[model samples]
Target chain A: MPYELYYWDGIQGRGEFVRLALEEAGADYIDVCRGPASEGQGIYAMMAVMKSKSEAHIPLAPPFLKDDDLIISHVANILMYLGPKLDLTPEDQGARHVVHGLQLTITDLVAEVHDTHHPIATSKYYEEQKEEAKARAAEFIDNRMPKFLGYFERVLRQNPKGPAHIFGDRLTYVDLSLFQVFEGLRYAFPRATAHLPTQYPHLAALHDAVAKRPNIARYLQSERRIPFNEDGIFRHYPELDKNAA
Target chain B: MPYELYYWDGIQGRGEFVRLALEEAGADYIDVCRGPASEGQGIYAMMAVMKSKSEAHIPLAPPFLKDDDLIISHVANILMYLGPKLDLTPEDQGARHVVHGLQLTITDLVAEVHDTHHPIATSKYYEEQKEEAKARAAEFIDNRMPKFLGYFERVLRQNPKGPAHIFGDRLTYVDLSLFQVFEGLRYAFPRATAHLPTQYPHLAALHDAVAKRPNIARYLQSERRIPFNEDGIFRHYPELDKNAA
Candidate 1:
């Protein structure tokens, strides 16, 4: 059976990570919320799962997947489940765990990226938190971003198989997710990541390789790929982008 | 052979999640960094694994587990690896995934808690960002904390196995982690969580139950249980606690 994905319809948000995996694997899946409510594939359908009394596993938020009777949530956890089934992870047990660990770290970096715009609270408007966001973005660009990106670069360099991929020579879901991170960072903080090609050469190369992949290339050019916007986790604010260079 | 757990020497931090599992399961393990450096079991030992070129999996941060040749990092990933081996997770595959999802949610909450004091930057001192910290704390108390706690409460209510535990009737590592979260919140934001007994009764009950467990009770009183301080993830700051009520 084709997988069913539940997420907000408007923006990519965290759902994009899961979407990247599904798109790259060319898996048969439905973007449930993007469909109409008349066909039982809209926000209501997603809310049904969220508010479902019968669901043994209630997802805290969207970007959850349903395959057969199994429903799983959390970006890293969902990717971990999909990775093996879709052949996006290493087969060995230890290697699998390593990939999972990398994914979780990526999850951490994404959360930090979200905080750049919504440092005070997600419930409030960005206008209310603009000043704090500027300060937060400064720290993120100066310290946290480099720290996280550098760690990933080191991991790629240390990968025994080759630096071409995060794990073995074959691409894993992590490599795809890293590419998304690179894409998002560039969109969100162009000046901040202007030197990424030299600073994070391996990640830049991986991003290029993943972008050139047949499936991902088609998905990127297709309407399926959502454009980055202010409403998304990675947002571009001119004032906050200052000092990023 | 006994597993080697590596984390910072002084504070509980994220490593406490892994330690709670080892303590509750009565598994043979070493708190590697807590031991003396002379015996190659201090921060140096932990750094060796992280910096080692020979190690197949280099941890992004501390709180990684070293089991013979295999090294796994990230709190939830480490617990997922240890959960099955230590028999802390539910037996069924679907149920196991549910527990993992819950653990990842808990991880999200912990990261937010860390941000309450360090909303602007982790590299900067709390004093440097005191105003931002206060604003962040207000939002955390008013919105984020309640949202996360309520979600878990709904999960407990929806659990087919009863509300005594998060999953089945038995205690999983998630329950232990929740107990720690409760403890940390109570310590860090006493005013914010003062009414937790009435608000999050299931979590309160779970915390109580876990605390009374023979092993957990001992662990709590022993030196192994590091007290919450400014150096750790959950820090008690009087200024940040304002208006929490």
Candidate 2:
């Protein structure tokens, strides 16, 4: 059975989380809206399919996954579906709930990141709100970054299993996502993240461990992975970067 | 088994969605955080029970659910966990995916609502971001509103069950959530929703049908149902309201 992954090729955005899962799982899948199609290829063709409505069920956005019989949307929800399928979620319901609670916290963090730039509006240009972004970025840098990262660091530190994996000892999708958040934060806020890992050794180790995972390492090296850029969610605006002092 | 809900007093905010699900299902529960301390107790005590450490798996935020041995957070994730338990989700994986898809869309909508006033920064006053918010709010009202509500209207139209419910003939968690979004939007963007409801009959019908459901109806009449207020996500600012004229 073939799985079709749909997302805009213009930016990594939210789609990459799902992509990371698929890559790590080594699933048989195609980045439908992405990849080569010669003349009518890449993201354009994928967009055509999404807007076409010929496909059985339409996903609300690109990050949706189409398995043989199921079309799943929502980043965390998609991970929920793929988790048990790929041994990423714990078998027990209680554990899964804890994992989900943590993922939702990550969702909150991601929203904050988006806000650091857009602040008041998603429809306008970031430049239009550049002044607003500066203030929002300051509050985010001062309050939110610490609040969110601190919560995760606490979760890691308080984990019963010696502060290793977020939920279970084995790597879960939540762990992988935390790694992504750290990577994106570092890319976007190197000055901030440099000071961050020191506060949470376990989180840093987990981020490093996930990056070293064989499949992720391969995927990162491969051309399939899209590089982070200004257009993407974690864009680095040197102005938003905190001072090292 | 007792179920406890923790959130601030007054205004449904995010907690309303959870309240709707619990009410619709006629579940045995308590809205502890909002209830009178003499009878229901404050959030601190609610926190005490939640963080008892007997389970040691307490949620990081309010609006979490504690049912017997399981606890969950995130509005949508909580619904996902509760959907099956309350028999609000479909039996098949495909249907469940669709339901989860809608829930996540609601999450996006919620975030957008928060952005309307806090377009520049959530940590600062709306007054500070008023200018940027005016621009963002205009785009949100003009573009995102129609896009989101229109897509949902299409979902209802395409539901294959006479467009009475969001999913099918029966009431699903998503249906209740859709109604909540309608109520929130109406409260937050009264003029905008009014101008647009005629354009999406299916969604309008959904808002009506869910309102009349027995349990939901009772809950609305009860004082337990908080009115929309400035403290919540969907704030009503006259400037942001679309003039019916």
Which structure among the candidates has the greatest TM-score?
1
Best model number under lDDT: 1
Residue pairs in candidate 2 whose N, alpha carbon or C atoms collide under 3 angstroms? A119-B119, A120-B119, A120-B120
What value does the lDDT take at residue B58 in candidate 2?
55
lDDT of 1 by residue, A1-245 (tens): 99998899878899999999999999999999998888988899999889888666588898888988888989888899999888999899787888999999999999999999999989999999999998889999998898899888988888888799988889899999999999999999988888899999999999999999999999999887889998999898877785443
Task: Output the number of the DockQ-best candidate.
Answer: 1
Worst 10 residues of 1 chain A by lDDT: A236-245
Candidate 2 regions exceeding 4 Å error are: A38-41, A53-57, B36-40, B47-57
lDDT of 2 by residue, B88-164 (tens): 98888778877888888888888888888877666778898787778778878888878888778777766666578
Q: Which residue window of length 10 is worst by lDDT in model 2 chain B?
A: B49-58
lDDT for residue B176 in candidate 1, whole number 0-100: 94
